[model samples]
Target: MAKLELIRNFCIIAHIDHGKSTLADRLLELTGTVAKRDLQEQLLDGMDLERERGITIKSHPVRMEYAAGDGNTYELNLIDTPGHVDFAYEVSRSLGACEGALLLIDATQGVQAQTVANVNLAFKQNLKVIPVINKIDLPAANLELCYEQMEEVLALPREEALCVSGKTGEGVKELLEAVVSRIPHPELLDIPGTAALIFDSNYDTYRGVVNYVRVKNGTFRRGTRIRLFNNGIESEVKEVGFFSPEMRAADELTAGSVGYLLPNLKSPSDTKMGDTITDVKDPCPEPLPGFKEVRPMVFSGIYPIDTADYEQLKASMGKLQLNDAAFLYQAETSAALGFGFRCGFLGLLHMEIIQERLRREYNCDIIATYPSVIYNVYMKSGEMIPVDNPVFLPDPSGIERIEEPIINCHIMIPSEYIGDVMNLVMSKRGICTNTVSVDARHVIITAEIPMHEILIDFHDKLKSMTRGYGSMDYEPAGYRADKLVKLDILVNGEPVDAFSSIVHTDMAYGRGRQLAERLKDVIPPQMFQIAIQAAVGGKVIARESIRAMRKDVLAKCYGGDITRKRKLLEKQKEGKKRMKQIGQVNIPQEAFVAVLKATETNS
Candidate 1:
């Protein structure tokens, strides 16, 4: 093991498709941590879905050995982070584990919304930032332009920016040397107690939960009592190791080293991200800076397509929750869809990933309800409660106010498309606060918009309007009072709680009308005309009717007497009345998720 003074810990940060993973693969190869043949593209992205989507959904940490020009071998730990703003929290955790960051920019695309946001975050963390322009081998690569944007937008050095090709390995050797020289070694803390930051973890069915940590103060070894300072949970260490892209047993990890610790954690929740790890005998006087608690901003109900799959879905979710503490769910019953779990997520991507994992990993078929954001309701009795699912929302009379979440959204796009993009955002109730021109071609637009407004198709719209040249990053701007109402869908006068949603008062009429019409298209006609009504507090805003199956009662009575025709008509009326009374509308599973399907199509 390298001495503390020779250790360098850092991470790669960039915007989506900015070549973060490819650059990481290059770094791994430079260090010879993994042989050339062993590397597949984006090797750090472990999940198949990640490869399929061409994105990094998780942060991966690895340790490497590099021999710098200074004539000393250094222990280099690289924590690779996700690029999308939806995974911003994950990026923060990864950043917290490092002392420096490699800010990679696309030589062609230049700085973007996430690029600016992540660089600012790194600055906030006080990590040494190294700007490296990537993809210089591309035909459209413009190194000087990227440098100008980096300097203007990120306040980074123009000349100090290094140009490299992550694909062709151009200038990579110099980049590694630069990392060793420029990125300072981790500060050696000689405090009496031991301390480590638990930035990430993964669960294994066989060996249990393994926590990835950056040793901040003292040594950690196997067969010793250890404690998680946040929850004061302690257990004897079962194993201690390091990841050179793969687990390798280590005798001990001291201050300034990155490694993994296993305490036989059977449940992943036990090893919470951002928790502090310390030696049980001489614990730290205080825990390291506690990470911000991430709450699920978007929520929806998930039901099994097959009723028998409920237990399977529940089991899958339980195991998934063990692996992902951010995913939250509780038992919920819908009058229209039967029993299911109401789940909460950080955003749309997180929600989509979890749903896809359930389908692909667990082989479960499920229907998800319309996603909604949490709302704060003040009741008539001076009580305040958070309602994530519409079913829990109290009557309008009983509630004094409803507060909805809002966000400060940052958008980066080419200057030519700003008009259309701005108009689209403004239509979603966005209020622009600031705009800046990094150069003549690119601009950054900052706007405040409702969090839920961007829940469905905001990104897709931005990309479409900008001709796929726009990107967005956002942070919560807190909540404010809004004119909100719960729009309920009723089929033949019977309300379907599963189709209920909270919407802005101004959009209630049009959205309700759209939903009712769409429902009409999907619903099969009953023996009697089916009335689909969209209502708010018992007041109907829009309505649609599905024509019933009609029969020519007199067709078979061509030669029959008028008395016979009258008798048949009476019998038909009785049958219609009986069907309308005893027969329930059989809503197809597709009908339950029609809004989701529509949103997907739009996206």
Candidate 2:
């Protein structure tokens, strides 16, 4: 085997669609990690959604053998990380595992906000950063503009930025050489203790909890009994191996190398992202940094359309939690929807991905309420509890204090969109911090906005205002005290917990009206009229009436035209028997899906 000095360990970081994944694919093919004829696009994006959306959801590592200029072959470890802000935790954990980062910048779009964030994160980690201006093969590519932007924003030398196109492989060789020249070599840790950072993990049926870790010091072999420093859980290692990225595994790995271990850990709850693996012989004096617990900024209730599918829905959620630890759920029982989970997520994209994965992966149809925020309630006894569904909210007479989360948002758009975008933010309870010209064409606008205000169709609205030339990102910035109220949705004079939402008092008027109008289009006209109202306390701020059907006719019969009305009535009775009775109205499966779609579609 080649010595450790010739090895290179690093990861690629970029904004979404900035050609990070494409560059990884080309590097793999160039180094013989993947055969030329057996190439598949975006090989690192293993998830179906990631492939379909052209984004990376998980951090994937691959090992390749590259021939250096000295006519010697060296092992290259390349880690590919996701670009979206919702997956910041993932990006940070992945960043912690590598010694260096390759920051890819778009030649046409200079230095964007996300690129700056990634560069800053790498600097915080003390990782060597190499800036690569990608898509230089495009006819409109301006290398000088990108170099200047990197120098101004990232404070990197113009000579350090390598111009390359992942598509045509132009200047790729120089970029590879840059990695070896700039990125530092992994040090041989001499400590006797064994400790590794669990950057990410997944559960396997037979192997139990399989964790991916980068050993910072010492070594571990198969059959070694280890303890997790964070939770103090003990387990014996079933096996140890490294990612081949070629459908196989390596026998052993050491400090400064990435690998996986089967701890025989049964439930995925036992292992968490950012947890550490320590030595059975002599553990680390301090545990690797503990997990930074994430609270859901967005809340919503999920119920199966058919009440009989409730058990199936629960099973699907349990299976999903094995692979995804971010989803938070509570045993919630609603008067209208019965038993289901009140789920919480980090943001709108995170919520959408969980809902879509449930439907597509588990094959269960579900109804999700509008995403909102958690409200805090204090009773006469001075007891405080967080309320996700407004139905459980206490009467206003017993309230004490409330708080809401704030976020630091960055919006980059064309110069012409400055006025409309700022107006939209101001209307949505957003305060601008500053604005900077990224280049002559685009401006980076910074603002602080409440998390709830942007949960509903915010991306679409931003795109519309900017004429599809804007991109934005947000990160949680502590909590602020605020007066909040819960808006209850009553259907036919009864409140539905699944439809309730928490909102700031100032936004209650506009939000309630918007919600009532949305439900009016969703709940179909039935045998009896349905009332969709948004009520704060006992008074209703907004109301919309879904009128009952005005005409009823049997369009056709299965056989030839039947003059006897009895035969048609019999068929109608059979259909009604199959339908579900929700309150005074009977609805079919088709109607349920329509309402669910309507619940998601913004008015």
Candidate 3:
């Protein structure tokens, strides 16, 4: 077992593209986690999805041996966390496993919205914050400006801040020394019991659920009888191990170290991200303190494009959810769409990942409805029900009162885009709460808006307003009563429940027009014209038509070309078979994406 005094726990925090991942790679290289010659780019980020997207989707816990100026080798546990707002919950879970955070500020950009949010979160978690200003190699790098921002925003002293460029290794040694001297060593709890907190986990095609945990209070060995507090699951520790990018069996993992436990717990729900793993022989308190069951924030319906793939889609969801506890699934039956899943997710990215993986990994194509927010309704008799889909929503008469969740959003943009952003925000029913100049050229804008309004395209609008120079972060605030209406999409006068959403009146017209135009792009031309209507209640707000294809085939083919033409026709027929027949119209994958992405282009 590793000694407590030899362990150091810290997380790397920064805004997007602030060189957080690059710095992590340098640290691993400096500590010999990867040899100088064999090193690949961004070695700390193991996921291809993460590397392609240029963002860390999950926290990576890596152990390294670094030699200090005092000529002593110390073991360092560095955790790299996602810097995006969509993965805020995951970031929080990762922060819980560490004792300190390395707050990196881009010397050119100074501090950003995510920077403030992460610092506040680290403070709330009681983790020590070590401020490091990165990218001093850039010509525009303003070290003095960054230091002032850190001192004013994060309350870090000028003397404590370290300057480093992970790109060129400039002043990086001083930064490493700061990490060793400034960050507190983990004071591993030495209680006479086995208790660990699961921070995150992933599903391996072969190994099942690979749970990442931090030993909070004790030690555990293989074959230990452990009980998970999240879901009353009891299982023998089939495997007790630590991650070296891959799982390696360890006889026992002591307090202060991060490791994985394969409880052989079939379901990811059993080993939740925040659940406590305690010794079944001598269990801790009734339940863990920080264990709040994760609830999905956005809900949508997913149906296979080919109805034949329905069973495959369900099986895929089950396997995927085993590692992604944030995904919620329930069998749903729609009058117009047949049977599908009422899937829920933390946010848009989470929803998109599941959908993308379903097609990419499972080899099954599926169609999804517009992402919708959950609503709480109180009836005349004072009964409350959580309505996830607008199709299941009770009539307005049945609803004595209805309220939707609200979010407190922060958008940091260049000063040049203030007017355009303000107009956009106001149109989305966002009430500007506060606006402050973060620096002479940039402003931080805060707003309180309905979660539904900004869920679709708020980020895109902020980006467009500032010419892709702005950043945003938001969190759920609470629920509020508003003038909300169920907007439904109708094809051939038949309402498609999957395409229905509850939206505010202020945004209905703009969103409706966008949806109509997108539907025109997505819906394939059929034998007859297809009418796409965006309606509120019984009234139509916007409409578009997809004209039937006039010349979709080769009229005359010579010789061997006839065979090719016949094959093309066969392919078209196969494609049409996968589409849903709405009266005379055929709806394909492109149509579904069109409706889903209509609101994606807000500006």
lDDT of each: 0.88, 0.79, 0.79
Question: What stretches of model 2 exceed 4 Å from their correct place?
Answer: 188-192, 378-382, 518-532, 545-596
Evaluate model 3: give its TM-score. Answer: 0.87
Q: Name the runs in model 3 displaced over 4 angstroms.
A: 188-192, 286-288, 334-339, 509-534, 540-599
Residue pairs in collision within model 2: none
Q: Which regions of candidate 1 fall more than 4 Å away from where they truly are? A: 559-571
Root-mean-square deviation per candidate: 1.7, 6.5, 7.8
Please give the RMSD of candidate 1 to the true structure.
1.7
lDDT of 1 by residue, 486-578 (tens): 999999889989878889899889888988988888998888988999999989999999988989888888875789999999999889888
Rank by lDDT (best first): 1, 3, 2
Per-model TM against the reference? 0.97, 0.89, 0.87
Instruction: State residue 603's C-alpha deviation in candidate 3, in Å.
Output: 8.3
Q: Model 3 misses residue 280 by how many Å?
A: 3.0
Report the error of model 3 at residue 153, Å.
Answer: 1.8
Best by TM-score: 1
